[model samples]
Target chain A: MILVADSGSSKCDWVLINNHGEWVDKIKTEGLNPLLLSKKNISNTIDKVQHLLNKKHDSTIDKIYFYGAGCGSSGSGNLIKDLLYTTFNQAKYIRVEEDIIAAVHATTQEPGVICILGTGANCCYFDGRRVIQKTPALGYLLADEGSGNYFGREVIKSYYLKKLPLDLEESFEKEFGADLNLLLQKLHNVDSPNKYLASFATFIFKHRQHPFIENMLHQGIAKFIDSYLLNYKEELLDSPIHFVGSIAYYAQDVIKKSLDERGFIVKSFIKKPVGHLVNNIINKNIL
Target chain B: MILVADSGSSKCDWVLINNHGEWVDKIKTEGLNPLLLSKKNISNTIDKVQHLLNKKHDSTIDKIYFYGAGCGSSGSGNLIKDLLYTTFNQAKYIRVEEDIIAAVHATTQEPGVICILGTGANCCYFDGRRVIQKTPALGYLLADEGSGNYFGREVIKSYYLKKLPLDLEESFEKEFGADLNLLLQKLHNVDSPNKYLASFATFIFKHRQHPFIENMLHQGIAKFIDSYLLNYKEELLDSPIHFVGSIAYYAQDVIKKSLDERGFIVKSFIKKPVGHLVNNIINKNIL
Candidate 1:
């Protein structure tokens, strides 16, 4: 079976294709970003995946394609590739890349803009084979303009500013207790600030239609377009733009509206990119 | 003796003037904003003032003019006036007004804009007698456009986004740490989120020359102008705007730059409003 894996900051999705170009199985596992997890953590996660796969299937896994968060740079990609090779000896071939590439492939890379809006965010100009141009994602701190982290940070601000309705404040305070010190400690002290902030975006999703939340999404998406897509102005206008992430799936209207306001057409929205990667791997080898 | 009291969110400054208009004594005490403090707290603060005056030769303290935060509304102003009357029997007259009025008075109410940028922010267009037109101050949550709270929040984002230099990041992490959860929890759950956020603005004050901080100040100040002053295009251009607040005093260059960029001239910059208030109160009685 040929295995294709797409890992993000929070979780990883895996798709397996059999030798005859037939689908085998699909599963999900905990996230494994090398920048966030230690060597021991990576090993433990790999072990858990192996144990789960063994219990579910009798067939042996062969080729593996791993695209993940924190693998954007060559150094980080090499480190993740080395770790995967040491763990999966039965796998004949392994290719590791930044998760954005998988998103690009999943969207067919048909001369358009591709964006990842999970815990953090990234965007690239893809022309089928490779990313011709890219902007810095800069994580949640400096950027993450239209991602979960942005939503999460805005939720905290809205609650503190008393911009939200009383009921929303009561719910948020009951759940999070309006303690900024503790929130800041967790965000800074923990390994994953992106996850820490993204946890709050769920609240925004719950109140997506509210004026404050709507305004936030409008401003955030405008900023994202201004910072990322606008840099490739000539290409963005002519090409189709697509998004890949859970937020894109959940907040499609917001994405669509923002794109409309900026005069861009969204070609597609794909939540998971592993399926497309699996198809690519299978077709390239067989066809 | 005439008492001029300037009460802000964090502290209150009291200036005593003798019969000849000579400065007698100046004292500082804990802040007394009715919105944040209870009736009992206000009473205790007044008692402290009486006790301090009693320590020196006090022959029935006369002509008390009090300017304070939360006094912009009639209800809050009446409550503060009632508290003063119950506390000081010898005080023959007591005048209560909004803190922004004090800021306007300090700037001589010269047909221009006045802004207060302490722990929070308030702005108004003054025509000598009263605020001719006003925009909502709405605390730090909904507004506080050109204030410390706004700058502090932006600074924290810049730090998290790695936009700051390595040296600055190390300094920030060492002082504030990387944990955003704790920072956020304290900001929300603490006694005052506005104050908590404003505290971080001091960091920006320390590094005012840094390009990142400069950019942040520009963005914040520009947004403030865009939302408030810029809306009154005709009035803004006709008059010379003046500012009265700690942020305005400290970051005068930034304020000047923000105004200059929009082609608005500034008449004056005052650190405190007590002098202006005294001048106004005296002028009103004389007239």
Candidate 2:
């Protein structure tokens, strides 16, 4: 079987394809980021994946492709590969890459722009299987400009500013409480501000119809396009753009509207690129 | 001469009222806050006042009424009073209280809510003489629910989210740049996130007529009132509301419309309560 794993800071989605290019099984395990997770956490996740594999199939995996968070640096990717190689010894070949690469490959291998809109966000202009130009996706603190974290941060600001509708404000306070001192301290002082900010996006998703939120989403997507695509000027103007991430998958209409208004066209929206990546890997016999 | 001084965080506005209860001279000086300004800064501000007095009247001050920022805290206020007392030895009385007190006194202490809407914000229920109840105004990180800081923070979010109009977004980027990494670092890591957030409010002031901004101000004010007053449920049903701040002065119609929609009767809107406080002190002879 050919195994493909897409790991993020929050969770990992896996797909196992048979030798004949037929779908076999799918599995989801806890998040596995080598940078943030401890050895114990990594072991626990591996054990869980093993248990799921045992229940689903009898044969050992022949090859694997891993695309994960914190895999941007070679050191981080090697750390994850070392851990996985030790666990899945039967695997013949193992390759690890940054999640953005997988997203780019899955969306458009031919020169174009690709964007990730999950918990955090990142974008790049892919020039045929290679990232030609990129913008910093400095997580929640620096950027994450067009992602879930951005939406959540805006919602909290609106709540604090009392700019939301009275009923929404009351609801927010009821759900999140009025003690912002504690909330802000927790968000900024805690180790994971990204999670804290991302959690608020659910509140935005819940009230997407609200004018303020709608405007927020529009502005956020516009900013992302402006920052990544518009900066490239003439090179990116005629290129087809595509999105790969949960936020883009769910909010494609909003994204399309924003792009349309800005005189740009969106070619495709794919929820996750793992399936496409797996197919490509098997077709190319690289796994 | 009966010297009357009303100081806020930004600047100090003073009037030298003669025995006839008429203004004989006026002066403006740099802000004097014991917490923010050093003794040297305070002395410099005082020197400016003295220079103004000497340049205009060539007469020494006799009695003084000094109300200012940092005066709400006994320690800070005493420090300020001691400095002013030593400088103007001819003045017999130098009383200091919270700046909001001056706002309340100036607005006719007739049982209503008072708000300060400059760089930061503070709100309190006033009963003629003293503030009966106050929601904690812990700068920007903890609070500052309804002020320029709130407006600026929201605008930044909107710009980052790509929800702002292209022209507006371009202007914002041209003006402030979309380097959210730098912005967030400065906002969160700095000593005063309130000031950092408040700095952005100028963007709103510059584009107050924009629909997005108008909606933001309307929603922001509504949220503030709801948090402070509507949350009281039955007790706030008939209470009159009033505003005293730069924003209240600039956005009176927006504030009034927002409050009216929420079933509130806005009694007054004053730009600065220092004049009213001066009148009150003169009439009551309390100082």
* lDDT, residue B174, model 1: 81
lDDT of candidate 2 at residue B197, scale 0 to 100: 69
Model 1 per-residue lDDT tens digits across residues B162-278: 457887788788878887545644653454556677778888877777787777777888877766666456778677888888888887888888788779898888887776666
TM-score of chain A of 1: 0.90
Model 2 DockQ vs. reference:
0.04
Lowest summed lDDT window (length 10), candidate 2 chain A: A133-142
Q: In lDDT terms, how accurate is model 2?
A: 0.72
Q: Model 2, which residues run further than 4 Å from truth?
A: A34-39, A173-192, A284-287, B1-287
Off by over 4 Å in 1: A58-60, A283-287, B1-216, B221-250, B255-287
Query: Top model by lDDT, which number?
Result: 1
Computed on alpha carbons, the lDDT of every model, listed in order, comes to 0.74, 0.72
